[model samples]
Target chain A: MMIPLESFHLAEPVLAYLDPGTGSIILQAVVGIVLGAVFAIRMFWSRICMTVSGIFGKGGMEKDGEDETEHSG
Target chain B: MRRSTPAERRLPSSFRDPSGFLFQRDGTLFRQVNEVYREDFQRLMRPDGLYDRLVSDRLLVRHEEAPKEFVDPELGFTVIAPERVPFISYPYEWSFSQLKDAALLTLQIQRLAMEHDMSLKDCSAYNIQFLEGRPVLIDTLSLERYEEGKPWVAYRQFCQHFLAPLALMSYQDVRLSQLLRVYIDGVPLDLASKLLPSRTKWKFSLLTHLHLHAGSQKRHADDAATGKSAKARDAKISKFRLTALVDNLQSTVRKLEWKPAGTEWGDYYADTNYDDQSMAKKQELVARLAAKAKPQSVWDLGANNGHFSRIAAEAAGVAAVAFDIDPVAVEKNYRQIQSDQRKDILPLVLDLTNPSPSLGWHHRERDSLAERGPADLVMGLALIHHLAISNNLPFDHLARFFHDVGKSVILEFVPKSDSQVRKLLATREDIFPDYHEEGFEASFGQWFEIEERISIEGSERTLYFLRRKD
Candidate 1:
């Protein structure tokens, strides 16, 4: 059974600049930057939540007390 | 200046990392840690306690500072000498359980990092190595000082590198895991999301990690301003949340499951065209041939679920390595061994046609599949047809390759008239005119002496035991 790579290629359909005929370095770089930004935003959104909570403190979206409890037993 | 010999230059686990390469000048193997990675390496070893804990737990390979005189000049980097691993395996070559264990270990390391205010910067499954039956994280520089509330920077990577392939294996089909061989970066999430059943959206982990994760990654991948730089994201996560994330991931990974059953070749021995009498005769012949080899170690190539591998294992308690291309078959075989506490047999995933290649820095660290073999005895039962028809390998070439791996071999031959061979020929052009018993015997005669041949009852296939004299 071949597992398909689904959403990783989602941008393939919408991009008008991804022409295979010409080696357009500028176009490719623009596309890359766009994709990279989206990846970065998703990664940092959780951090943004925590930063907002850090200012207020009482009910932060995340907790960071070093608990060392074995969760796998 | 005299240069190092290629054999001496070979270092284990070096080919996977491309930033710089690893090589050996003397007997000791060393990784020329490049300047590009200098800061990350220092942070991982110093301010972060990842190095110490990983060493203490035996989850990472230990290394020492090396003298300048023992370095390779061609590849520019400061060489830090390290201990070598006994053997190397690729992700596509790992059993389902093996891959699962490695994934858990990676998450465990990530969890461990939270306490020390560090995080795994990359989540490539290739970074993990198996040494002496244990999974050890090989990339020491992957850990970085954790930013508070950065929401696991390697999340999409972790999902791509581990979760997607695993989920596909569990849900769609186990063979899908082989996509790692082609993708190099792990299966893409968009592809996985499409292949998965619609019901997967209900599973929180799958939804969050696979579907929503892929969607978010796609939308924001272009928005560079959205991701906070290291200074901006420092809202320290309470240790409890860190632990919760780890626990949640562990539970999520554990819950994602698959059961192996009913593949064409999976339950082969039981449903084979052979009757009980023929099966017993064949088994007896195989035992006799393998016993004569007096092998200390054996490899059962194309060992579908390992029924014949057990026959060869009776050859004086030797270690038996059972290899199959099918993930489901390998998984089932491994699970059975684990449940039964079978110690002598090691089940692995392998595609005979396109085997594992040496990867990492300079291709020195991990040895390719062929570099690790040439067992005392290799059993290639019911495997010739696939190689002959499916792969279109000639008999002489197969014989020579087998000779390269082992001193003795046991092979099975199925005529063109046989149902199995006919099924294979049906799909493609039947250009193999010399793919019969006569051609097999003649080709193998150049390197081996036929010791015994047994015809499986209730079938047209024949099994041969041959000893390589060359």
Candidate 2:
């Protein structure tokens, strides 16, 4: 899943922040965890399942042709 | 197969991953949030009062949730349409105070996120926009739950995006803020580090925020791609510490103040070529012409301190865009606007010779100055002489350019006989022999119909009201 982020068209003012310089790390970690978990789960689980489903549905004949070509070669 | 429509012609903002792109449907604005963002979206809306609090505080835009159906085939997310902002301005377009306000607003939002055990992953200024003179954060999904001790991931981005440019503008030159236009992902820290003076290293905030920050960035630059993601997950920051950090940033930013210095045309009225009566007559003539035009919107092309812009604004109740090449003049005009709380005028720094052009991805993202539009009426007071004599642009070209910008033009012609034009001509070639009244009328007549001409009592300058023909 994606995190909502704002995009500014032009440059922003260089005013001070409400948070200290050091405290930004905590926020970054929280964001990293949420985004990381979602991406990992999708790539490893749903992606494999989708590939397996596609093979069973349409690619079985293609797989047999490939195996025949390999044996002939 | 579903047939496609013209509504899907434009692309959304290309920076972030999980969040969908912003698109316009039938002139209404909407954002598409992917299923990838669903978990974070749920967390932001579920427990911490983050969404409601920000919306109630006016820190966020209030929106009606969009339906689940897909408008396009490629994207995984559906639309979550939001309210449209009236006029969007860029950082380069903002006055010093406007930018300062935006920075402070971003920090405020970040702090609130921390209080709710959420944190902002990215601190790009583009995510923030001004609504009715106040800065508001637009990117709702940028906030995620804070993890312990992994180091601020968006730290370098914050410094580059907000701190670097601000420091450069504050310490080096105010005009340096334009550097943001060239650096899309904010000014590069290495470049910012180089441009800043040696003395900046001595300042504590500048040292930690810019110099040392640059050093750390350089060291970890490549490591960011492969570094331990899980290490970041285990660390957490306290709420009180976050507030303290906010206080530190506020104080640091507050300390970085810039004093406006005088520039050419900033003190123009005070050091004019005209005597008091002549000045009064000029003002009277300008006011009369402005009233006659009856413009709903006026652009004072070379508005020096906005003296005539005020006349048009006050007389016609028109919204005026007062533009000048001089930041000093624009700064002074901004101060005036702030003092009076005048909602009708916007003063901007613009070099007429080389106006802002279309910049960013595919040269289509941020529009050029001309692309913004043709003002209803345009004024070229004391500007033609500079363009004609100094810049060497022909009177015909000048007239043609003005014709394209405004339907009606109230232009001031300073004759070759005039001291200012003479002084300009004395310095160089007077190829503009057609720079006289006869020549002006002849060249301009091709594009415009001369409506009226009034001469100021004690000055040689003449103001002409011309409506574009054809």
Candidate 3:
């Protein structure tokens, strides 16, 4: 005998609440690391270059100072 | 709280924010703050001192509390009325510098909010509005208390709305900023990543924010499809790290600059046929006509750097909107407005051929250019030839459009014999047979009554002041 299909009650399925696109959050994490590293490098690169140049080329320091003043002015 | 009548209407665009929504009672606007947002509202108003700081800096719109009766009894905890902006403009209507300024202002507000133990819950460009010739944040409900180790919830929204559009405009074509009109929630990051040049991947900021970010989004989408959605909750960022991220984003924005140059209309005044006498005469005529009408608001179409618009504004003491097709021209106009501390003129980029249309939910959130008007007066100086000859728009069509958008128009008609008209004819075939002064008069005469006409002193152009027929 074939059973009737209308007798059962199905519970409502719970849907996940995603306020922002799931893709957006994942992407942010990957980008944050890269952004931090790049910022650190950019912040220190000029100072490091200046220090190394100063140590290696002591006689050229006066010329560099003049150039810096000219550029700044 | 006072009882609201049946006339109380809520704005559709303001419905999404659960904290509060803007409603109109009679003709005045009011914002109803719900009980759910009481704590945050108190933080913004009281202990934090954020409201006072932002208001004093003029970074945020100012508002005053209304009686409790003004609120809806069910959903409302408090009611407040904000100062009305003269005209509400959308992101798509803004020029490059205007969008950039809005972006910077959002970041500055975010930084300020962090200091007050709060963070912006949303970073939608729609929250910002131009007031008193400057951009100011209008949403009081956009802030929430900051948690110690939660990722900035608005990061993605900020990137899509401000960073993506700014980057695209700076690196690629300026017109690409129009993508904001199509994507009301801001341009999709994946699309932005793909549209950007491959070399942009080598630039640290673009590499991290756009290209790699797009890749991660794809991966997350794939994971979500397989029912792995819980991963989003697992990813947490410290508050210090969040501040650093914001700082980096600010620096990226600061570095991405577009110097508006090389556009056709940018150097228009330099090569114009007008001599000093003719220019002065034109200015005098415009001022006299404007004074006669005494319009409260004026729109200067094709206002290249706002030379004549200023005459109307100053003479009539009216608020003027200076619109141009060229970004460079609008930029120059805005820079002058800033430096001069002028409160009357607001410059925006607009191509008349395809002006900004109504967009967002049900096409009602942002108003179309036509809906914002019938301005008191519209000045179309040296603009007809380009629309009529260059764009192949008939005189009748131009007349109808102008009549519909403004109560009165001051139109400058450039005859076929004019050098400017000759220049336009040099490039294209002379298809406009009825582009002469008589055809112009006959077509516009149907919709308007010609009040006065004057021949400019050293040019073939004749300026006509027409008032729309009832």
Highest TM-score scorer: 3
The stretch of ten residues in a row with the least summed lDDT in candidate 2 chain B is B9-18
Candidate 2 residues B77-155, lDDT tens each?
Answer: 5667777654445677655655666676677777777767667777878777766435677777677655433244456
Q: Say which docking band candidate 2 falls in.
A: incorrect
Error of 3 at B129 (Å): 1.8
DockQ of 1: 0.03
Pairing residues by index, what is the TM-score of model 3?
0.86
DockQ of each: 0.03, 0.04, 0.16
lDDT of 3 by residue, B326-395 (tens): 8778877877777777878888888999988888789889888899898999999999999998899998
What does candidate 1's lDDT look like per residue over B192-230, in tens digits? 999888889998668766776667556544434545322
Better of 1 and 3 by TM-score: 3
* Residue B96 accuracy (lDDT) in model 3: 75
* Cα error, candidate 3, residue A46 (Å): 13
Which candidate gets the maximum lDDT versus the true structure? 3
Alpha-carbon lDDT of model 3: 0.81
In order of listing, the candidates' clash counts read 46, 26, 4
Lowest summed lDDT window (length 10), candidate 1 chain B: B228-237
Model 2 global lDDT (CA atoms, 0 to 1):
0.69
